[model samples]
Target: MAETSDQDSKTEEPTEKKVRDALEQGNIPVSREAPIFASMAALMVILTFLIGRGVQQITLTLKGLLDDPDGFPLGAPADALNLLTVVGLEALRFLTPLLVIFAVFGLAAQLLQNAPNLVLQRIMPDLSRISPLNGWKRLFGTQGLVEFAKSMFKLASVSAVVAFVLRSSEAKAFEAMYTDPVALPEMILSIAMRIVSAICIATIVLVAIDLAWARFHWRRELRMTKQEIKDEHKQAEGDPLIKARLRSLARDRSRQRMIASAARATLVIANPTHFAIALRYKREENAAPLVVAKGMDVIALKIREVAEQNRIPVIENKALARALYEAVQVDQVIPAEFFRPVAEIIYFLQSKQAPRPEKVQ
Candidate 1:
């Protein structure tokens, strides 16, 4: 049983149908590293654009508080609350742009990883998700190990990048420290930006590796078993027995309609057994003769019955009947190339008494 189970799960590549079904179910592979990379990159951009203004604003606020200590409320609780509110508002204003930037990057990262698709199933709850076995599998299985390894690698890589940046700039940073105090803030900001740039570059490399792994892993997970492929094929093509029955029913209805249409035909040209084509012509209504009905074998026999019952002429001309049956469809004019032959037959029928019905071959 165990071997059988393994065999059933042996498929290593997903079919296109499986991938489409998985997408409909909102089961897509996601890389945790993608969001981390986007956030870090956004931070690098934000810092590059706003760090100098942010630092200068905060420094001014601090200096104002220090220089005017008496301006701050001291004892009264209401006054202290007012003072706190002002400071809180200032901090909120400073952080709001960063928060917005983070949110935009997060959204962009998710959309990049999985292009926009409406998946109603994703919002629906599944009891299977709460099962203890599934939870345990997620916590302790290969996925858990992979996640842990990724986290450790990211942490180590970022730490290594920061250390390298700091080490390389140690001389410049030390020199800045000994320079004018008035220039210290700008110098510090420059060093911080350099470190952020290095970290962003490193995170980008991790994101690329994770994206490739995620796609490969997703494809493997969506693979179908041999039985699943068979089932999907059956679903797409329909059950052969059921399809055959439907086709038989359709043919029966079509044959019945052909017989009814023969009621208005001028004559039926038949091959004596296998082929029958009913022709109609009206000089006032149409310029050419129309093939109103056609059939083969058993249907040809029925067409003969209908033609005789309606007093429609039945001419047995094997070659003409076969050609008309092969080339012309019900309600269609016989092609111009065969018009002369059909016209001659019609002229003969008009000039003579309608022939008695003959047995169909």
Candidate 2:
């Protein structure tokens, strides 16, 4: 169980590391609805242009028929068929450009908003697909209120534009009907263009406002509290208890390895209380001394057992051992200050000389 806990701790670090990496990337979340408003604005502009052009064309055709009905031959079946075909084709042509413009603008709006790449999940049906609770919540929500206001604003703006255009053109439009048929179509076309342009401009303003609102709401929804981030990390990885157990098991395994290595040490230096440091050196093979093992209390006892079993020398140096344990870590060279004393110990052992107990002078 301890071994498993140790393994878990080692694995947990990578998961946390990945979360940290993602946070560092600093991706800003966006609302899905913002693009819809932008796209609608683009579509409205296209519709305005197309409708204005179509109305002008239709007005010209009407003027041509009214000015000289015999010359245009509107009564013949073949001529009527050809005229209908031309009008139908012209309407399609007008609408085609608008369709293409809307499609491109919609795509661009989505891209600029940094929406997530299209995924199957968005299109897939789920239990919430038909939820009346969600419907009611949306209908009575802030978004619904915004939509209602937008509708009223559009209605009022269009009504005002129509009233102004009709009042200004009523005299001229009436005079043109009796004076010249061509002038009649021109007047009608002029009125239609003014109305369409007003509607388009109004739509653009509303959509821009809606897009801004959507962005603000999206940011609010994505804001994460510090505690929430922590909880998410824990869920993605595991709890602290499991991580602590794993670390303990790892330390135990490391201690076992250290003890096994200490058996080959030339000497064990002890603080005579808590610390123990074992040093090993090989002349002609190593340029400097190496620490084979280090520990405290129970770990110190374990180091002693390994040294004694291997017939390695043991020395009690309260100050030097503690300093070595504190200043140097395992598999590191002893500090320069302790080098002379440590060298003398090594020299005596290698030369088969008697052990000397000399205090630093």
Candidate 3:
């Protein structure tokens, strides 16, 4: 009941990252019936194609030994060993193709459903797997009951299919008792082929249904609660407080750099306490005045202090400082609209540097 309540609370679909992590951990949606179908398919193939020739070869080898046992010195233990080796080799040769077919079919079945992923976690030892409580839960839980129902359905369906196949061949089977031993092999193979073919057909339908259900059930199980989704979001995007702190640190570093660069400016435009824009101008270095640093409040005071220490001129201009601070970026040439006012300031500074032509002598 508690588990069902927990499952019901997962209203949100699993995120891609959650699904990816599950895949990496080897938690994949695999229908158990798919591999059973593959085995049935392999068996059908063996019955249809390989079994006839394989059985023929083995029978011929066995017949050679059995038909003339008197010809061989069976009294000698070495002779018996030689005969055993031949029989074993022939048996192995016959079984090899069957084994290969089963292996290839099984691997293909798994590969078709999920791409191969190597997950060591799956192979790692875990106490939970052996815990009696967990085992009991697995055997009696809702999912366990569903699994039980599926197993029972498969067993009944396959049994019915096998019974029907056997019934259809009942006449042939009864005649096998009276039939010649030589013809018995072909008759038996034919009946076995029909049974396996019917089983394969039956399992193909089950495989389709089970494959879809397995994936759907897997996704349903992975669904996230609202709080889990929010927690995952926070983890991915980062904590709000930490992000704000980072932004604050970035602004502080920027202010420090701005104050440091202000020492290179030729003149500092100030609105007393609120705004300061430091301009660097050189006829040979730039086409127009460059605002190398600008700041407000505490940073504005820092820029002014740096300007004072560097002996750079601090010109008070309430309107121009406010306008330039709004319009200009640090390290960029001031725009055209403010050219006249700023140019007049440059002119005044140049006038101060103009050689007093001469005290009129």
Candidate 4:
């Protein structure tokens, strides 16, 4: 049972590595609609301002037309042509800013969400857009359902507001029309205000619904099962066997390097039979001691070979070597606890001209 568990852990090691790689690369796909909703809310506020500005301009234009129809002459051929041109230009001017503002806001929303670039793939010969089946499906889909609901809600809300406004202002509205011609602007504004308010309220309700739907779908799409995540990692990386082979190759190379490094060490500490660690220290001018070489079994054997070839002294301190190997890594300072013992060993080795007998500490 223990052997089987060990084998299972070994098998999973490569898969774990692959999963970590995938996470670092940001290959994960996530929905962008939450940001879209937040941006739309901002857009709605901007639209309200734009609408008010447009209404003001339209009101002024209408007043000018009413006060002097001949001066702005809609009936004359040249005057009509000029008026049409002006109106067209004004419409463009109004729409351009709104379009630009909406586009910029939409882009910012997408950017915030880290949305991938969209690539258009023409699927099914482009007939799907016009197909009755597709149309029906869309009509029955969440978007279509929302649109239907919005239309009904707007109708109900507007009808209610209009009824209330008309009932409350019936007498005053009539009296203003009769008493003051200049008060036409004020009356027009009051009616416009009621209509705008109803529409704004209806829009707010629709936006809220849209936001809720977006959030629901975003969560649904982004939810990943553990198995699905595992599969995705596999797909993004490679099969487990290939990953395992790569890791095996890496560990072999690391073992080789460790053996070569340990060969250069002046002393090797061994755990008698199970573990071995080699350590080399250099005391250069104005520099602290630096470990030049260090390594376990096959690596320890290779270090021993290199030390024999170079005729470098090799001392075997079973306890100290095992402790150093377990507690300190290569290229790191020996722990404070082991420093004194290591220093004593180094001093003894330096003082001895011959290979010292195994010292039992």
Q: Any idea what lDDT model 2 has?
A: 0.71
Tens-place lDDT digits, model 3, residues 1-361: 7978998999899999999989989999999989999999999999899999998899788888789887667788998998788888999999999999999999999999999999999999999999999999999986688789889888998899889988988898899898898998888888888888888888888888889989999999899999998889889999889999999999989888888999999888898899999999999999899989999988899998998888787888888889999999988999999889889887776778633211110
Model 4, residue pairs in steric clash: 263-303, 269-321
- Residue 288 of model 2 has an lDDT of 70
lDDT of 4 by residue, 1-361 (tens): 6734443444222344444444354433333334444455545655456766775786677678678777766666998899888778877866777777777777665565554543334233477799999999789876578668766765787688778777877887779857868667667666666655655555566556656665555444344545655787788788899999999999888777767776566666555444666667777521323344455666666666676676666666777777776787776656678878877877877777546334435
Of 1 and 2, the candidate ranking higher by lDDT: 1
- Cα miss at 197, model 1 (Å)? 3.4
Cα RMSD for candidates in order: 4.7, 9.1, 4.0, 10.7
Candidate 1 achieves a global lDDT of 0.83
Q: Write the per-residue lDDT of candidate 2 for residues 1-361, one digit (tens) a residue.
A: 6734443443222334444444344333444444555555665565455656776776687788689777656677999998778768876766777778778877776677664454555567776757998787577776677667767877897798788878887897778857867566556666766666666666667667766876665444344545556777787678888899999999989989998999878788887658889998887656678898999999998888787787777777787788888888788877787889788767766677435422232
lDDT of 4 at 20: 43
lDDT for position 278 in model 1: 87
Q: Give the TM-score of candidate 2.
A: 0.70
Best by TM-score: 3
Please provide, for model 1 over 262-343, each residue's C-alpha lDDT reduced to its tens digit, 9 standing for 90 to 100.
8899888999889988888999978999888899998898888898898888888888888888899888899998899888
